[model samples]
Target: MAETRSTTAPRVVRREPTLTGELLAEFAGTAILILFGVGVVAQVVAGQNGDDDSIHWAWGLGVTFGVYVAGRTSGAHLNPAVTVALAVFKGFAWRKVLPYSVAQLLGAFVAALIVRWVYADAIATVDPRTTFDSQGIFSTLPGAGVSIGTAFLDQVVGTALLVFLIFAVTELRATPPAANLAPFIIGLIVVAIGFAWGSNAGYAINPARDLGPRLASFLTGYSTAMREPGGQFYFWVPIVAPLIGGVLGGGLYRVLVERHLPDQTDAEQPTGRIPAEDD
Candidate 1:
């Protein structure tokens, strides 16, 4: 018999990706994350769903819950922006980023599904009819008057400040409380950022936080609102800026300050606040 080579390409089996414990962490983190996040915005801005007055403070509690739930597992990048920054700045493994992101997005979608189910009647009753952009809806809007370049720069600088602070308080491993204190401290920082700079571009700071919710909102059937036409939405900024800021922040810390990494014992639960005084 004459030797005949097959014309078709050789079949190389692509090994299927398997779900692991890390995936669960990502899912759990993203779910509780959107719950606290969107749940807060829904309570305030959604008319019957959002009260505007009391919902704001309840928003704080939501932040606290989000961190407690997601902190240990997957470090809760709930936002894509944070995930990018984590890899670049904190030395989080690159291999994990895509999986974490997919998990985060899926988690957000599931969480949104749950919220929609809970507020089905509320969602239908609203006069104007809004898709649940609750998480990104009230939080940030794009800069109306600025040029695209300026707007982009603003997001980068603003998000960097936010992420940098995170690195300082958390990555510096300032003390035993730094890890446990993650939720409260992060929530407070967000509160301040919203008050000061959130007006333009929503102070998203974390891409996963906003983008995941935004994606869920769009997928679940909110119109062009989340899309933010003409880059007026500035979604790209939130995604890009934070990564830049996070790296800058990390670099600054490495150069300016000496690292005094906290021990494993620091993660243990404690009785009182770790003194804020810097050593």
Candidate 2:
């Protein structure tokens, strides 16, 4: 039998944005976060420009802008703690976790470099005695009296509060804020965490936010960047503790609030947070 070709032309397949694009969004979102967040710290510590209030607002607004920048694309989970929590409890894909985390870390690292560059002269002048101690401008530092265990606990509690409140704010079934206010409420949570727990450990509630900038400071000549003032190898505390706390927070929120909700706005899909409208 002879084969014959069909007259119909082949249909074109439109290529969607790849993981690379998502990763870029994550990177950019996280960069925006660190740019303002760490920049405010530099302003306060180096230039004596503002106090704790400035830091709190700056970091909160940083998160807000970051989410706005990448929410549609990557969901703007600028913090690894948040990302992991979503994966565990909010239906985020597990496969993308590492990529998102690495991208966030890179963004934060690069932003720290930019902040250091911008404030080099001011930092040098701020403390004529030492440059390394200025690493706190880019990363977190525990208070003078806080021990390692105390700082770790502080980070856990702070991050747990952060993730838990995030779940609450984003919940679709519950009374989510009116008028797409999740991002703003999320920002406020960060501000609240800073105001409440910042004195204990500088409130490094996000692993990427803390570790990425700290890595930059270490690479750039801060000998004690990874260690605290009292010979404490405190670098891992934020990274590990936030991950733990975030998972705990998410789980706790699901158990405490989500399971109890009767509205079930997203009953079919059952995601804890609001599912994006169908494309």
| Model 2, TM vs. native | 0.88
Instruction: Please give the distance, in angstroms, between residue 199's alpha carbon in candidate 1 and its true position after superposition.
Output: 0.5
Worst 10 residues of 1 by lDDT: 270-279
After superposition, candidate 1 runs with Cα above 4 Å error: 1-19, 48-60, 127-140, 143-150, 172-178, 229-234, 258-279
| lDDT (Cα atoms) of all candidates against the true structure | 0.60, 0.84
lDDT of 2 by residue, 142-229 (tens): 8988888988988898989998998887776667775356778778989999888899899989988998889888787687888888
**Candidate number with greatest lDDT:** 2
- Counted clashes in each candidate structure: 11, 0
TM-score of each: 0.70, 0.88
Question: How accurate locally is residue 21 in candidate 2, as Cα lDDT from 0 to 100?
Answer: 84
C-alpha RMSD by candidate, in order: 12.9, 5.9
What TM-score should be assigned to candidate 1?
0.70
Pick out the ten consecutive residues of candidate 2 with the lowest summed lDDT. Answer: 270-279
- Tens digit of per-residue lDDT, candidate 1, span 1-279: 999988998899965324465567667766775676566666445544554333434544555666577655446556565666667656677787787777777777677667656655555556245633443442345656656566567677666676666666564344424557777877676666666665566556666666666665566656654555453455566677766766666566656652544444755634443212111
